[model samples]
Target: MSFSLFRASVRRAATAPRAQLRSQLRIPLRKFSTPPPEAPVPTPKSNTTLYVGIGAVVAAAGVAFYSFSDSGSNAVKTGVQAAKVKANFVPTKEDYQKVYSRIAGIFDDAGDYDDGSYAPIILRLAWHSSGTYDKESKTGGSNYATMRFAPESQHGANAGLNVARDLMENIKKEFSWISYGDLWTLGGVAAVQEMNGPKIPWRPGRVDGVQTQATPDGRLPDASQGSDHLRKIFGRMGFNDQEIVALSGGHAVGRCHSNRSGFDGPWTFSPTTMTNDFFKLLFDEKWVWKKWNGPKQLEDKGTQSLMMLPTDYVLVQDKIFKKHARAYADDEALFFKDFAASCAKLFELGVPTEQWVSPEPWIMKNVDEK
Candidate 1:
């Protein structure tokens, strides 16, 4: 008989009801065995047939034991165990969208937080986690999500990020299967989209790494530094002048905390919404040094309520950076397009192309769309 037919027979016998199996077992063991008087000398073809028959018999016997040896419940339990082994959980885009929805729901839950929204800090967490990338050494970046460990988490640039981390921990508990790198970056994407920013195309594949993989300190930018420092830092991550200017537009939403960065105040009037107002205010008004005991930062002369970091001020001071900044200030649509592209690149740093689940990034819909 063909092997396929033999296997099909075995499957039918294994799945038979317990009473049927008992009756079949009683039919006769001698019927399946070769008669001693008529048995031929062993040959390759005969041996192969004998082995296949033996295997089928053994398989059917094991299945019968599991199915009827104890109770009907045992048979169901065995089937479940086999099914579990055959089905492994793989998250799809819809699963990721559910995660995105959860994050967006919690953005404004904290009444005491800056601007009454967790969106800024969540975006910062994604930024700092990814900003650690070193193109030459391939040491840092979002691939590992190493900020959960020490040294990197304790880095000066990461101060007050614990709030962001703690906030994400809650989300992690709810979606236990997601890696930290994917979760944090997804949080950033959700924050941007919910705040009316550009639709950042995203995909999932990043895996969690150990403490030994944590990047060294100073990989992130220093807010006190100027244009040269900006170039050296972002350049290390393989970003150009235009990309740097485009990324700086992120300052439009978040404010500095005295307890965190030492320099205090929001970069724009609306510290919660996404807008090109940061660029507009950068050139539209004069910036003067804020007279404070804190670290040196610039304040708008018009209202003095808004603030800009030394790194931010350098964009207008440096000619190349100024050219791009001028363009963004003139065109909000262009700023959104560039920001989405560059930020998507930043979030995907250190992740291998093969690890991505999708050929193209997914543009997750905003919560309002749902």
Candidate 2:
């Protein structure tokens, strides 16, 4: 069985920036539902959200239009000028590749990061940044890199993600035309592929978020919950059982920090690399409730070193979730295919399909792939 890995060839020439398309079409969702008529007092902890500065030019149409509210009442909004943003120059695929290299290069260069690489945190930034989408209200998701501001920044689920954001911000300085939504998600794809994970199809068009556009906290999954909660949370984003398990494969990479999530330990031995190991170990190992002062979590009875959250444990306990979990453990190839498709959907949660510039999202070549 082959791992399907690729190393970068000498950098290749990228296509020129394409023409910008201006649409008179009004976005279906009313930008942001005008803040409720009886809005509460704007406290420091109230509606304010975040926007990390990343300039994005449309790769397809070439326009710099960001979806969501044009008004300041939005919970999470982009700071980019709503009017057409002129780039110092039009961005080409080469521009994006430079960004991919930079994201890949950070892992080798960062001396102060986890697992000797920035892969894990970068995935979290992509997940947390995009996980906020609520299909019901048509709010949240990666469209606006809303986690940069308040309330959302200090949210429990987003704890420690500032590290990932700070890292991405450094890249934003170099590529001013890429949106934070696109850049961070691309960083996620880079981290996964470089770490030997699947190739996730990523597209650009995310606008930067504004302070007022921030979504309320508590939207992310809580490790303390069970299968019902899993459905409730991911379900809100419109994810089903199969997609939920596939996304959880991400835990194959990155350990929980005692200081950050309060839960501790790696789910798989190779936390910096992606593998079916998360599922393999989930079935192969004997897990027992971790005896700890921190919080109620699971420890592998085989070796007390590895950990699983109450949430992860439920995947096997529940009948429906267990079925999918076992399928992944049995077949790495199946897991990879499903994980790629689910993740591609995960990143595009709140984005309107029509807004995407490319009819087929681009599969960016990995640093290893020529």
Candidate number of the best TM-score: 2
lDDT of 1 by residue, 1-370 (tens): 0000000001111133323533544521110111112222233222333333323332343355355433354344334433322233344566677788878888767565565567878888888889889999987888768898787888878887788899888877676656678899999898787767999999876756656678988778887888888889899999999999998888877677776667676776565668898899999989999999998888988778767788888889999999999999999999999999999999999987655666678899887674
Which regions of candidate 2 deviate over 4 angstroms? 1-84
lDDT of 2 by residue, 1-370 (tens): 0000010000101111101100111211111111112311222231111111222323322222233334443212233333223222334455566677778777655443554567777877888878888989999998877787788888878777777888888877666556778899889888888777888998765766555668998788888878888898889999999899988888887777667777777776666667898899889999999887988889888768777888888889999989999999999999999999998998887876655655567788876555
**Per-residue lDDT of 328 in model 2:** 98
Against the hidden reference, what TM-scores do the models get?
0.77, 0.78
Model 2 residue 245 lDDT?
A: 90
TM-score for candidate 2, residues paired by index: 0.78
Query: Given candidate 1, what's the lDDT at residue 190?
Result: 86
Local distance difference test scores for all models: 0.71, 0.67
- How displaced is residue 100 in candidate 1, in Å? 0.1
Clashing pairs in 1: none
